[model samples]
Target: MIHSLDPAPSAQAAMLDGATPLTQLGVIRVEGEDAAAFLHGQLTQDFSLLGLSEARLAAFCSAKGRMLASFVGFKRAHDDILLVCNRDLLAPTLKRLSMFVLRAKARLSDASENFQVFGLAGGGVPAALPTAVWSQWRDGQVSVVRLPAAPGAVRALWVAPVGAAAPTATALAEPLWQWLEVQSGVAMLSQPVVESFVPQMLNYESVGGVNFKKGCYPGQEVVARSQFRGTLKRRAYVVHAEGALVAGQDVFSEGDPDQPCGTVVEVAPHPVQGFDAIVSLQTSAAAAGGLRAGSVSGPHLTLLPLPYSLLEDI
Candidate 1:
Protein backbone atom coordinates (compact mmCIF):
# COMPACT_ATOMS: atom_id res chain seq x y z
CA MET A 1 0.00 0.00 0.00
CA ILE A 2 1.11 3.59 -0.66
CA HIS A 3 1.82 5.60 2.50
CA SER A 4 0.41 9.02 3.37
CA LEU A 5 2.74 11.96 3.86
CA ASP A 6 3.16 13.94 7.10
CA PRO A 7 0.71 12.88 9.83
CA ALA A 8 0.32 16.55 10.63
CA PRO A 9 -2.77 18.06 9.03
CA SER A 10 -1.16 21.42 8.33
CA ALA A 11 1.70 20.01 6.26
CA GLN A 12 -0.53 17.80 4.17
CA ALA A 13 -2.87 20.75 3.84
CA ALA A 14 -0.41 22.89 1.89
CA MET A 15 -0.55 21.08 -1.44
CA LEU A 16 -1.71 22.92 -4.57
CA ASP A 17 -4.06 24.75 -2.28
CA GLY A 18 -2.76 27.55 -4.45
CA ALA A 19 -0.92 28.16 -7.72
CA THR A 20 2.87 28.10 -8.02
CA PRO A 21 4.93 28.56 -11.12
CA LEU A 22 7.00 25.41 -11.81
CA THR A 23 10.03 27.26 -13.10
CA GLN A 24 12.26 24.24 -12.69
CA LEU A 25 10.56 22.09 -15.29
CA GLY A 26 11.18 22.52 -19.00
CA VAL A 27 9.13 21.44 -22.00
CA ILE A 28 10.01 19.77 -25.32
CA ARG A 29 7.71 19.74 -28.31
CA VAL A 30 7.71 17.05 -31.01
CA GLU A 31 5.54 17.67 -34.00
CA GLY A 32 4.86 16.51 -37.56
CA GLU A 33 3.28 13.34 -38.97
CA ASP A 34 5.83 10.97 -37.49
CA ALA A 35 5.85 12.19 -33.89
CA ALA A 36 3.91 9.28 -32.43
CA ALA A 37 5.69 6.64 -34.48
CA PHE A 38 9.08 8.11 -33.66
CA LEU A 39 8.55 8.32 -29.91
CA HIS A 40 7.16 4.77 -29.76
CA GLY A 41 10.50 3.49 -31.01
CA GLN A 42 12.58 5.80 -28.82
CA LEU A 43 11.05 5.59 -25.35
CA THR A 44 9.66 2.98 -22.95
CA GLN A 45 5.97 3.91 -23.34
CA ASP A 46 3.60 2.96 -26.13
CA PHE A 47 3.04 6.31 -27.75
CA SER A 48 0.99 4.61 -30.48
CA LEU A 49 -1.80 4.09 -27.93
CA LEU A 50 -1.56 7.49 -26.28
CA GLY A 51 -4.84 9.37 -25.97
CA LEU A 52 -5.29 13.10 -25.84
CA SER A 53 -6.86 12.79 -22.38
CA GLU A 54 -4.03 10.81 -20.87
CA ALA A 55 -0.41 11.54 -19.87
CA ARG A 56 2.37 9.00 -19.45
CA LEU A 57 5.37 8.82 -17.13
CA ALA A 58 8.19 7.31 -19.24
CA ALA A 59 11.94 6.96 -19.28
CA PHE A 60 14.57 7.42 -21.97
CA CYS A 61 17.35 4.92 -21.43
CA SER A 62 20.89 4.26 -22.55
CA ALA A 63 21.84 1.11 -24.43
CA LYS A 64 22.83 -0.51 -21.14
CA GLY A 65 19.35 0.12 -19.67
CA ARG A 66 20.28 3.05 -17.41
CA MET A 67 17.82 5.92 -17.46
CA LEU A 68 18.99 9.13 -19.16
CA ALA A 69 15.86 11.14 -18.49
CA SER A 70 12.28 10.64 -17.40
CA PHE A 71 9.29 12.52 -18.75
CA VAL A 72 5.58 13.18 -18.30
CA GLY A 73 4.34 13.04 -21.88
CA PHE A 74 1.01 13.87 -23.48
CA LYS A 75 -0.35 14.56 -26.91
CA ARG A 76 -1.91 17.91 -27.72
CA ALA A 77 -3.01 16.61 -31.14
CA HIS A 78 -2.46 13.62 -33.40
CA ASP A 79 0.80 15.06 -34.59
CA ASP A 80 1.88 17.14 -31.61
CA ILE A 81 3.39 15.68 -28.45
CA LEU A 82 4.90 17.50 -25.50
CA LEU A 83 7.30 16.15 -22.86
CA VAL A 84 7.81 17.88 -19.54
CA CYS A 85 11.01 17.24 -17.56
CA ASN A 86 13.58 19.01 -15.38
CA ARG A 87 15.05 22.17 -16.88
CA ASP A 88 18.63 21.19 -16.08
CA LEU A 89 18.32 18.01 -18.13
CA LEU A 90 16.34 19.36 -21.07
CA ALA A 91 19.09 20.75 -23.30
CA PRO A 92 21.28 17.65 -23.29
CA THR A 93 18.29 15.32 -23.44
CA LEU A 94 16.90 17.20 -26.43
CA LYS A 95 20.22 16.97 -28.24
CA ARG A 96 20.54 13.26 -27.56
CA LEU A 97 16.93 12.65 -28.59
CA SER A 98 17.45 14.52 -31.84
CA MET A 99 20.33 12.25 -32.82
CA PHE A 100 17.88 9.35 -33.24
CA VAL A 101 15.53 11.32 -35.49
CA LEU A 102 17.65 10.48 -38.54
CA ARG A 103 15.15 10.82 -41.38
CA ALA A 104 11.90 10.68 -39.39
CA LYS A 105 9.39 13.39 -40.25
CA ALA A 106 9.27 14.54 -36.62
CA ARG A 107 10.74 17.77 -35.27
CA LEU A 108 11.98 18.23 -31.72
CA SER A 109 12.68 21.58 -30.06
CA ASP A 110 12.83 23.14 -26.60
CA ALA A 111 9.50 24.75 -25.97
CA SER A 112 10.25 26.00 -22.45
CA GLU A 113 10.41 29.61 -23.53
CA ASN A 114 7.07 29.37 -25.31
CA PHE A 115 5.04 27.87 -22.44
CA GLN A 116 4.45 28.41 -18.74
CA VAL A 117 3.99 25.56 -16.27
CA PHE A 118 2.29 25.76 -12.87
CA GLY A 119 1.44 23.50 -9.96
CA LEU A 120 -2.07 23.78 -8.56
CA ALA A 121 -3.61 22.35 -5.41
CA GLY A 122 -6.46 22.80 -2.94
CA GLY A 123 -10.27 22.98 -3.10
CA GLY A 124 -9.94 26.23 -4.95
CA VAL A 125 -8.71 24.47 -8.10
CA PRO A 126 -10.97 24.71 -11.10
CA ALA A 127 -13.86 22.25 -10.97
CA ALA A 128 -12.83 20.84 -14.33
CA LEU A 129 -9.35 19.67 -13.30
CA PRO A 130 -8.64 16.03 -14.12
CA THR A 131 -8.98 13.89 -10.99
CA ALA A 132 -7.12 10.70 -11.91
CA VAL A 133 -3.36 10.45 -11.80
CA TRP A 134 -1.79 11.08 -15.25
CA SER A 135 -5.16 12.00 -16.71
CA GLN A 136 -5.16 15.16 -18.79
CA TRP A 137 -7.65 17.64 -20.23
CA ARG A 138 -7.04 20.67 -22.39
CA ASP A 139 -8.95 23.78 -23.29
CA GLY A 140 -8.06 26.12 -26.12
CA GLN A 141 -5.46 27.86 -23.96
CA VAL A 142 -4.65 25.64 -20.96
CA SER A 143 -3.88 22.01 -20.15
CA VAL A 144 -4.06 20.29 -16.79
CA VAL A 145 -2.87 16.91 -15.54
CA ARG A 146 -3.80 15.46 -12.15
CA LEU A 147 -0.66 14.44 -10.23
CA PRO A 148 -0.50 11.80 -7.52
CA ALA A 149 -1.42 13.22 -4.10
CA ALA A 150 -1.90 11.98 -0.58
CA PRO A 151 -5.40 10.97 0.42
CA GLY A 152 -7.61 14.09 0.82
CA ALA A 153 -5.00 16.20 -0.96
CA VAL A 154 -5.71 17.40 -4.47
CA ARG A 155 -2.86 18.27 -6.86
CA ALA A 156 -2.55 19.14 -10.54
CA LEU A 157 -0.18 20.48 -13.21
CA TRP A 158 -1.14 23.51 -15.24
CA VAL A 159 0.47 24.28 -18.63
CA ALA A 160 -0.24 27.20 -20.89
CA PRO A 161 1.39 29.80 -23.08
CA VAL A 162 4.04 31.97 -21.40
CA GLY A 163 1.84 35.05 -21.36
CA ALA A 164 -1.25 33.28 -20.01
CA ALA A 165 -2.60 34.30 -16.61
CA ALA A 166 -2.01 32.22 -13.46
CA PRO A 167 -4.59 29.46 -12.98
CA THR A 168 -5.49 29.44 -9.28
CA ALA A 169 -7.06 31.48 -6.50
CA THR A 170 -3.67 32.50 -5.12
CA ALA A 171 0.05 31.68 -5.36
CA LEU A 172 2.04 29.23 -3.28
CA ALA A 173 5.74 29.51 -2.55
CA GLU A 174 8.02 27.46 -4.84
CA PRO A 175 9.77 25.77 -1.91
CA LEU A 176 6.43 24.52 -0.59
CA TRP A 177 5.53 22.95 -3.92
CA GLN A 178 8.94 21.31 -4.17
CA TRP A 179 8.55 19.93 -0.67
CA LEU A 180 5.15 18.55 -1.57
CA GLU A 181 6.71 16.78 -4.55
CA VAL A 182 9.24 15.03 -2.29
CA GLN A 183 6.50 13.98 0.14
CA SER A 184 4.57 12.52 -2.77
CA GLY A 185 7.56 10.13 -3.36
CA VAL A 186 7.74 10.80 -7.09
CA ALA A 187 11.11 12.31 -7.86
CA MET A 188 11.75 14.26 -11.04
CA LEU A 189 14.89 13.78 -13.16
CA SER A 190 17.85 16.15 -12.72
CA GLN A 191 21.52 16.36 -13.76
CA PRO A 192 23.29 14.76 -10.80
CA VAL A 193 21.41 11.46 -10.97
CA VAL A 194 21.48 11.03 -14.71
CA GLU A 195 22.46 7.57 -15.97
CA SER A 196 22.68 6.34 -12.39
CA PHE A 197 19.73 3.95 -12.27
CA VAL A 198 17.73 1.36 -14.10
CA PRO A 199 14.04 2.24 -14.19
CA GLN A 200 13.25 -0.21 -11.36
CA MET A 201 15.89 1.24 -9.01
CA LEU A 202 13.82 4.42 -8.84
CA ASN A 203 10.46 2.56 -8.78
CA TYR A 204 9.67 4.01 -12.18
CA GLU A 205 8.06 0.81 -13.44
CA SER A 206 5.76 0.54 -10.41
CA VAL A 207 4.58 4.10 -10.95
CA GLY A 208 3.63 3.65 -14.65
CA GLY A 209 6.90 5.05 -15.97
CA VAL A 210 7.91 1.91 -17.87
CA ASN A 211 6.00 -0.12 -20.45
CA PHE A 212 7.43 -3.63 -20.57
CA LYS A 213 5.08 -4.91 -23.24
CA LYS A 214 6.12 -2.28 -25.72
CA GLY A 215 8.58 -3.47 -28.34
CA CYS A 216 12.32 -2.80 -28.00
CA TYR A 217 13.72 0.60 -27.15
CA PRO A 218 17.40 1.28 -26.31
CA GLY A 219 17.71 -0.92 -23.20
CA GLN A 220 14.76 -3.27 -23.52
CA GLU A 221 16.77 -6.44 -22.97
CA VAL A 222 18.41 -5.33 -19.74
CA VAL A 223 15.21 -3.84 -18.32
CA ALA A 224 13.27 -7.00 -19.13
CA ARG A 225 16.03 -9.15 -17.64
CA SER A 226 15.95 -7.25 -14.36
CA GLN A 227 12.19 -7.58 -14.12
CA PHE A 228 11.80 -11.22 -15.09
CA ARG A 229 15.03 -12.65 -13.68
CA GLY A 230 14.69 -10.95 -10.31
CA THR A 231 18.02 -9.17 -10.75
CA LEU A 232 16.78 -5.95 -9.21
CA LYS A 233 18.72 -5.50 -5.96
CA ARG A 234 18.17 -1.77 -5.32
CA ARG A 235 14.89 0.14 -5.05
CA ALA A 236 13.75 3.61 -4.16
CA TYR A 237 12.59 4.42 -0.62
CA VAL A 238 11.59 7.53 1.34
CA VAL A 239 13.64 8.54 4.35
CA HIS A 240 14.13 11.42 6.78
CA ALA A 241 17.41 12.96 7.87
CA GLU A 242 18.34 15.95 10.02
CA GLY A 243 20.73 17.93 7.78
CA ALA A 244 20.95 19.04 4.18
CA LEU A 245 20.70 16.16 1.70
CA VAL A 246 22.07 16.33 -1.82
CA ALA A 247 21.05 14.23 -4.81
CA GLY A 248 23.55 11.59 -6.01
CA GLN A 249 25.21 11.51 -2.59
CA ASP A 250 26.24 8.14 -1.24
CA VAL A 251 24.36 6.36 1.56
CA PHE A 252 26.22 4.06 3.98
CA SER A 253 24.93 1.30 6.23
CA GLU A 254 26.38 1.10 9.71
CA GLY A 255 27.03 -2.62 9.32
CA ASP A 256 29.32 -2.08 6.33
CA PRO A 257 31.41 1.04 6.01
CA ASP A 258 33.45 -0.48 3.19
CA GLN A 259 30.65 -0.11 0.66
CA PRO A 260 27.97 2.51 0.07
CA CYS A 261 24.43 1.18 0.14
CA GLY A 262 22.52 3.75 -1.90
CA THR A 263 22.37 7.08 -3.69
CA VAL A 264 20.08 10.01 -2.98
CA VAL A 265 17.79 10.65 -5.93
CA GLU A 266 15.87 13.68 -4.69
CA VAL A 267 15.45 15.78 -1.53
CA ALA A 268 13.57 18.77 -0.12
CA PRO A 269 13.01 20.44 3.24
CA HIS A 270 10.16 18.89 5.22
CA PRO A 271 7.15 21.10 5.46
CA VAL A 272 6.81 20.34 9.17
CA GLN A 273 10.36 19.49 10.28
CA GLY A 274 13.82 18.37 9.17
CA PHE A 275 14.32 17.08 5.60
CA ASP A 276 12.93 14.20 3.55
CA ALA A 277 14.29 12.50 0.44
CA ILE A 278 13.96 9.71 -2.09
CA VAL A 279 16.90 7.33 -2.01
CA SER A 280 17.55 4.30 -4.21
CA LEU A 281 19.44 1.64 -2.29
CA GLN A 282 20.05 -2.05 -1.81
CA THR A 283 16.97 -3.81 -0.42
CA SER A 284 19.16 -5.74 1.99
CA ALA A 285 20.96 -2.62 3.20
CA ALA A 286 17.67 -0.90 3.95
CA ALA A 287 16.97 -3.55 6.61
CA ALA A 288 20.46 -3.35 8.09
CA GLY A 289 20.98 -1.40 11.33
CA GLY A 290 21.83 2.28 11.02
CA LEU A 291 21.95 4.38 7.85
CA ARG A 292 23.96 7.51 7.15
CA ALA A 293 23.80 10.04 4.34
CA GLY A 294 26.91 11.21 2.42
CA SER A 295 29.68 9.43 4.34
CA VAL A 296 30.02 6.59 6.80
CA SER A 297 29.91 9.18 9.57
CA GLY A 298 27.47 11.48 7.80
CA PRO A 299 24.11 12.62 9.16
CA HIS A 300 21.98 9.76 10.47
CA LEU A 301 18.93 8.87 8.44
CA THR A 302 15.61 7.32 9.42
CA LEU A 303 13.66 5.40 6.86
CA LEU A 304 10.16 6.72 6.22
CA PRO A 305 7.34 4.86 4.48
CA LEU A 306 7.17 4.80 0.71
CA PRO A 307 3.90 5.81 -0.89
CA TYR A 308 3.73 2.63 -3.05
CA SER A 309 4.57 -1.04 -2.70
CA LEU A 310 7.50 -2.65 -4.53
CA LEU A 311 6.95 -5.61 -6.87
CA GLU A 312 9.19 -7.94 -4.93
CA ASP A 313 8.11 -11.22 -6.47
CA ILE A 314 8.83 -10.11 -10.00
Candidate 2:
Protein backbone atom coordinates (compact mmCIF):
# COMPACT_ATOMS: atom_id res chain seq x y z
CA MET A 1 0.00 0.00 0.00
CA ILE A 2 1.17 3.53 -0.73
CA HIS A 3 2.08 5.60 2.31
CA SER A 4 1.18 9.25 2.69
CA LEU A 5 2.90 11.73 4.97
CA ASP A 6 1.42 14.80 6.59
CA PRO A 7 3.06 18.18 6.17
CA ALA A 8 4.93 19.64 9.13
CA PRO A 9 2.81 22.06 11.16
CA SER A 10 5.02 24.99 10.26
CA ALA A 11 5.01 24.06 6.62
CA GLN A 12 1.25 23.53 6.53
CA ALA A 13 0.69 26.95 8.04
CA ALA A 14 3.11 28.57 5.61
CA MET A 15 1.39 26.95 2.66
CA LEU A 16 -1.90 28.48 3.73
CA ASP A 17 -0.86 31.94 2.60
CA GLY A 18 1.94 33.35 0.45
CA ALA A 19 3.18 34.08 -3.03
CA THR A 20 6.60 33.37 -4.51
CA PRO A 21 8.33 34.80 -7.51
CA LEU A 22 8.67 32.10 -10.17
CA THR A 23 12.21 32.96 -11.17
CA GLN A 24 12.72 29.53 -12.63
CA LEU A 25 10.05 30.01 -15.28
CA GLY A 26 10.12 32.04 -18.48
CA VAL A 27 7.63 33.12 -21.13
CA ILE A 28 7.35 32.70 -24.88
CA ARG A 29 5.09 34.97 -26.81
CA VAL A 30 3.58 33.88 -30.13
CA GLU A 31 1.94 36.50 -32.27
CA GLY A 32 0.51 36.87 -35.77
CA GLU A 33 -2.42 35.65 -37.83
CA ASP A 34 -1.09 32.12 -38.12
CA ALA A 35 0.17 31.70 -34.55
CA ALA A 36 -2.58 29.37 -33.39
CA ALA A 37 -2.53 27.25 -36.52
CA PHE A 38 1.22 27.01 -36.47
CA LEU A 39 1.24 25.85 -32.87
CA HIS A 40 -1.71 23.53 -33.45
CA GLY A 41 0.42 21.68 -35.95
CA GLN A 42 3.43 21.39 -33.64
CA LEU A 43 2.11 20.79 -30.14
CA THR A 44 0.14 18.06 -28.37
CA GLN A 45 -2.86 20.30 -27.71
CA ASP A 46 -5.30 22.06 -29.99
CA PHE A 47 -4.44 25.72 -30.10
CA SER A 48 -6.61 26.28 -33.16
CA LEU A 49 -9.67 26.44 -31.02
CA LEU A 50 -8.19 27.94 -27.88
CA GLY A 51 -10.41 30.41 -26.08
CA LEU A 52 -9.10 33.45 -24.25
CA SER A 53 -10.53 32.29 -20.94
CA GLU A 54 -8.98 28.83 -21.19
CA ALA A 55 -5.37 27.77 -20.66
CA ARG A 56 -3.84 24.62 -22.06
CA LEU A 57 -1.26 22.36 -20.52
CA ALA A 58 0.55 21.09 -23.59
CA ALA A 59 3.68 19.33 -24.71
CA PHE A 60 6.10 19.90 -27.54
CA CYS A 61 7.56 16.59 -28.59
CA SER A 62 10.30 15.37 -30.85
CA ALA A 63 9.57 13.33 -33.96
CA LYS A 64 10.06 10.15 -31.95
CA GLY A 65 7.33 11.27 -29.53
CA ARG A 66 9.64 12.16 -26.67
CA MET A 67 8.56 15.38 -25.01
CA LEU A 68 10.97 18.29 -25.39
CA ALA A 69 9.09 20.76 -23.25
CA SER A 70 5.75 21.23 -21.50
CA PHE A 71 3.83 24.47 -21.33
CA VAL A 72 0.95 26.28 -19.70
CA GLY A 73 -0.37 28.30 -22.63
CA PHE A 74 -3.23 30.73 -22.95
CA LYS A 75 -4.51 33.13 -25.54
CA ARG A 76 -4.08 36.82 -24.78
CA ALA A 77 -5.81 37.80 -28.00
CA HIS A 78 -6.95 36.21 -31.25
CA ASP A 79 -3.41 36.36 -32.56
CA ASP A 80 -1.37 36.43 -29.41
CA ILE A 81 -0.62 33.55 -27.07
CA LEU A 82 1.73 33.31 -24.13
CA LEU A 83 3.43 30.03 -23.20
CA VAL A 84 4.99 29.70 -19.78
CA CYS A 85 7.73 27.09 -19.33
CA ASN A 86 11.05 26.40 -17.65
CA ARG A 87 13.46 29.26 -18.10
CA ASP A 88 16.37 26.91 -18.70
CA LEU A 89 14.63 25.36 -21.66
CA LEU A 90 12.96 28.48 -23.05
CA ALA A 91 15.67 29.51 -25.52
CA PRO A 92 15.98 26.15 -27.20
CA THR A 93 12.26 25.50 -27.11
CA LEU A 94 11.56 28.86 -28.68
CA LYS A 95 14.23 28.32 -31.33
CA ARG A 96 12.88 24.90 -32.26
CA LEU A 97 9.32 26.13 -32.47
CA SER A 98 10.41 29.08 -34.57
CA MET A 99 12.16 26.84 -37.09
CA PHE A 100 8.78 25.63 -38.27
CA VAL A 101 7.24 29.06 -38.57
CA LEU A 102 8.81 29.51 -42.01
CA ARG A 103 6.20 31.42 -43.98
CA ALA A 104 3.31 30.85 -41.61
CA LYS A 105 3.17 34.49 -40.54
CA ALA A 106 3.67 33.47 -36.95
CA ARG A 107 6.35 35.05 -34.78
CA LEU A 108 7.79 33.45 -31.69
CA SER A 109 9.92 35.47 -29.29
CA ASP A 110 11.33 35.18 -25.80
CA ALA A 111 9.25 37.56 -23.74
CA SER A 112 10.50 36.60 -20.32
CA GLU A 113 11.86 40.05 -19.66
CA ASN A 114 8.55 41.66 -20.49
CA PHE A 115 6.63 39.78 -17.83
CA GLN A 116 6.87 38.71 -14.23
CA VAL A 117 5.57 35.35 -13.04
CA PHE A 118 4.60 34.33 -9.52
CA GLY A 119 3.15 31.27 -7.90
CA LEU A 120 0.23 31.94 -5.59
CA ALA A 121 -0.90 29.40 -3.03
CA GLY A 122 -3.83 29.10 -0.63
CA GLY A 123 -4.77 32.50 0.79
CA GLY A 124 -2.26 34.07 -1.54
CA VAL A 125 -4.65 33.63 -4.44
CA PRO A 126 -6.45 36.80 -5.42
CA ALA A 127 -9.99 37.26 -4.11
CA ALA A 128 -11.36 37.03 -7.65
CA LEU A 129 -9.77 34.26 -9.67
CA PRO A 130 -10.74 31.32 -11.82
CA THR A 131 -11.51 28.21 -9.77
CA ALA A 132 -11.24 25.61 -12.50
CA VAL A 133 -7.88 24.21 -13.43
CA TRP A 134 -6.56 25.66 -16.70
CA SER A 135 -9.05 28.50 -16.57
CA GLN A 136 -7.76 32.04 -16.93
CA TRP A 137 -8.81 35.44 -15.62
CA ARG A 138 -7.52 38.74 -16.96
CA ASP A 139 -7.78 42.28 -15.68
CA GLY A 140 -6.12 44.85 -17.93
CA GLN A 141 -2.47 43.84 -18.04
CA VAL A 142 -2.50 41.10 -15.43
CA SER A 143 -3.43 37.49 -16.08
CA VAL A 144 -4.02 34.73 -13.58
CA VAL A 145 -4.22 31.07 -14.49
CA ARG A 146 -5.64 28.58 -12.05
CA LEU A 147 -3.39 25.59 -11.64
CA PRO A 148 -4.07 22.13 -10.25
CA ALA A 149 -3.94 22.61 -6.51
CA ALA A 150 -1.82 20.73 -4.03
CA PRO A 151 -3.55 18.93 -1.18
CA GLY A 152 -4.79 21.53 1.35
CA ALA A 153 -3.67 24.40 -0.86
CA VAL A 154 -5.20 26.29 -3.75
CA ARG A 155 -2.67 27.44 -6.36
CA ALA A 156 -2.58 29.81 -9.31
CA LEU A 157 -0.07 31.41 -11.66
CA TRP A 158 0.08 35.17 -11.49
CA VAL A 159 1.52 37.02 -14.49
CA ALA A 160 1.79 40.65 -15.43
CA PRO A 161 4.15 43.27 -16.83
CA VAL A 162 7.53 43.08 -15.07
CA GLY A 163 6.95 46.01 -12.69
CA ALA A 164 3.32 45.37 -11.88
CA ALA A 165 2.31 45.33 -8.22
CA ALA A 166 3.05 42.02 -6.60
CA PRO A 167 0.33 39.95 -4.91
CA THR A 168 -0.74 41.34 -1.57
CA ALA A 169 -0.30 38.09 0.36
CA THR A 170 2.64 37.34 2.61
CA ALA A 171 5.79 36.49 0.73
CA LEU A 172 6.26 32.76 0.27
CA ALA A 173 9.61 31.10 0.25
CA GLU A 174 10.52 29.66 -3.14
CA PRO A 175 11.34 26.33 -1.55
CA LEU A 176 7.82 26.06 -0.21
CA TRP A 177 6.40 26.77 -3.65
CA GLN A 178 8.71 24.10 -5.02
CA TRP A 179 7.37 21.61 -2.50
CA LEU A 180 3.79 22.43 -3.36
CA GLU A 181 4.65 21.92 -7.04
CA VAL A 182 5.69 18.34 -6.41
CA GLN A 183 2.67 17.89 -4.17
CA SER A 184 0.47 18.91 -7.04
CA GLY A 185 1.77 15.82 -8.91
CA VAL A 186 2.24 17.69 -12.16
CA ALA A 187 5.83 17.73 -13.34
CA MET A 188 6.98 20.48 -15.63
CA LEU A 189 9.53 19.60 -18.32
CA SER A 190 13.08 20.78 -17.66
CA GLN A 191 16.52 20.50 -19.29
CA PRO A 192 17.64 17.67 -17.04
CA VAL A 193 14.80 15.40 -18.18
CA VAL A 194 14.09 16.76 -21.63
CA GLU A 195 13.23 14.07 -24.16
CA SER A 196 12.93 11.63 -21.25
CA PHE A 197 9.22 11.06 -21.70
CA VAL A 198 6.15 11.38 -23.78
CA PRO A 199 3.23 13.42 -22.46
CA GLN A 200 1.37 10.40 -21.07
CA MET A 201 4.31 9.20 -19.00
CA LEU A 202 3.95 12.33 -16.89
CA ASN A 203 0.14 11.95 -16.70
CA TYR A 204 -0.21 14.92 -19.01
CA GLU A 205 -3.05 13.25 -20.86
CA SER A 206 -4.99 12.94 -17.64
CA VAL A 207 -4.27 16.53 -16.74
CA GLY A 208 -5.47 18.04 -20.04
CA GLY A 209 -2.07 18.38 -21.71
CA VAL A 210 -2.73 16.17 -24.71
CA ASN A 211 -5.50 16.28 -27.32
CA PHE A 212 -5.81 12.97 -29.16
CA LYS A 213 -8.39 14.37 -31.52
CA LYS A 214 -6.03 17.04 -32.76
CA GLY A 215 -4.34 16.77 -36.14
CA CYS A 216 -0.72 15.85 -36.75
CA TYR A 217 2.12 17.23 -34.63
CA PRO A 218 5.82 16.36 -34.35
CA GLY A 219 5.17 13.07 -32.55
CA GLN A 220 1.43 12.74 -32.96
CA GLU A 221 1.53 9.31 -34.57
CA VAL A 222 3.66 7.76 -31.86
CA VAL A 223 1.67 9.39 -29.10
CA ALA A 224 -1.58 8.12 -30.60
CA ARG A 225 -0.28 4.60 -31.03
CA SER A 226 0.92 4.52 -27.47
CA GLN A 227 -2.56 5.48 -26.35
CA PHE A 228 -4.69 3.28 -28.59
CA ARG A 229 -2.36 0.30 -28.66
CA GLY A 230 -1.80 0.30 -24.90
CA THR A 231 1.94 0.39 -25.40
CA LEU A 232 2.67 2.83 -22.59
CA LYS A 233 4.68 0.91 -20.00
CA ARG A 234 5.72 3.78 -17.73
CA ARG A 235 3.90 6.41 -15.70
CA ALA A 236 4.82 9.14 -13.23
CA TYR A 237 4.27 8.50 -9.52
CA VAL A 238 4.98 10.45 -6.37
CA VAL A 239 7.68 8.92 -4.17
CA HIS A 240 9.25 9.96 -0.91
CA ALA A 241 12.79 9.31 0.23
CA GLU A 242 14.65 10.06 3.43
CA GLY A 243 17.56 11.43 1.39
CA ALA A 244 17.74 14.27 -1.06
CA LEU A 245 16.72 13.48 -4.65
CA VAL A 246 17.59 15.31 -7.84
CA ALA A 247 16.08 15.43 -11.29
CA GLY A 248 17.55 12.95 -13.79
CA GLN A 249 18.44 10.50 -11.01
CA ASP A 250 17.71 6.86 -11.76
CA VAL A 251 15.54 4.68 -9.56
CA PHE A 252 15.89 0.96 -9.05
CA SER A 253 13.70 -1.90 -7.91
CA GLU A 254 15.14 -4.09 -5.18
CA GLY A 255 13.83 -7.14 -6.95
CA ASP A 256 15.95 -6.31 -10.00
CA PRO A 257 18.75 -4.07 -8.94
CA ASP A 258 20.67 -4.81 -12.13
CA GLN A 259 18.29 -2.67 -14.11
CA PRO A 260 17.02 0.83 -13.44
CA CYS A 261 13.28 1.04 -13.31
CA GLY A 262 12.59 4.76 -13.26
CA THR A 263 13.90 8.29 -13.68
CA VAL A 264 13.31 11.18 -11.32
CA VAL A 265 11.53 13.96 -13.15
CA GLU A 266 11.17 16.58 -10.45
CA VAL A 267 12.19 16.79 -6.79
CA ALA A 268 11.75 19.13 -3.88
CA PRO A 269 12.46 19.06 -0.15
CA HIS A 270 9.50 17.63 1.72
CA PRO A 271 7.70 20.06 3.97
CA VAL A 272 8.32 17.85 6.96
CA GLN A 273 11.57 16.04 6.20
CA GLY A 274 13.59 14.37 3.45
CA PHE A 275 12.35 14.88 -0.10
CA ASP A 276 9.43 14.18 -2.42
CA ALA A 277 9.64 13.57 -6.15
CA ILE A 278 7.71 12.81 -9.27
CA VAL A 279 9.33 9.80 -10.88
CA SER A 280 8.39 8.00 -14.07
CA LEU A 281 8.59 4.27 -13.48
CA GLN A 282 7.86 1.15 -15.39
CA THR A 283 4.30 0.27 -14.50
CA SER A 284 5.24 -3.26 -13.53
CA ALA A 285 8.13 -2.05 -11.38
CA ALA A 286 5.95 0.47 -9.60
CA ALA A 287 3.43 -2.26 -8.75
CA ALA A 288 6.23 -4.48 -7.47
CA GLY A 289 7.35 -1.84 -4.94
CA GLY A 290 10.79 -1.93 -3.25
CA LEU A 291 11.94 1.10 -5.17
CA ARG A 292 15.19 2.86 -4.38
CA ALA A 293 16.42 6.21 -5.57
CA GLY A 294 19.86 7.05 -7.05
CA SER A 295 21.07 3.45 -7.11
CA VAL A 296 20.37 -0.07 -5.94
CA SER A 297 21.68 0.65 -2.46
CA GLY A 298 20.47 4.23 -2.39
CA PRO A 299 17.87 5.58 -0.01
CA HIS A 300 14.63 3.62 0.21
CA LEU A 301 11.60 5.25 -1.36
CA THR A 302 8.02 5.03 -0.25
CA LEU A 303 5.27 5.25 -2.81
CA LEU A 304 2.77 8.04 -2.22
CA PRO A 305 -0.77 8.16 -3.57
CA LEU A 306 -1.14 10.22 -6.72
CA PRO A 307 -3.06 13.41 -6.14
CA TYR A 308 -5.22 12.65 -9.18
CA SER A 309 -6.59 9.57 -10.89
CA LEU A 310 -4.91 8.18 -13.99
CA LEU A 311 -7.28 7.87 -16.88
CA GLU A 312 -7.74 4.34 -18.12
CA ASP A 313 -6.08 3.73 -21.48
CA ILE A 314 -8.32 5.28 -24.07
The lDDT per prediction is: 0.84, 0.90
77-165 per-residue lDDT for model 1 (tens digits)? 89999999999999999999999999999999999999999887776456786677889988777888888774445678888888887
After superposing all C-alphas onto the true structure, candidate 1 shows an RMSD in angstroms of 2.3
TM-score for each model? 0.94, 0.96
**What does each candidate score in C-alpha RMSD?**
2.3, 1.9
Backbone clashes in model 2, listed as residue pairs: none
Candidate 2 lDDT by residue in tens digits, 1-314: 12345656566766557899999999999999999999999999999999989899999999999999999999889999999999999999999998899899998999999999999998888778868899999988888999998877889999898888888889988988988889789999999999999888999888899999989999999899888896579999988899989999999999999989999999998766799899999999999999999888998888888888888834
**Following a full C-alpha superposition, what root-mean-square deviation does model 2 have from the true structure?**
1.9
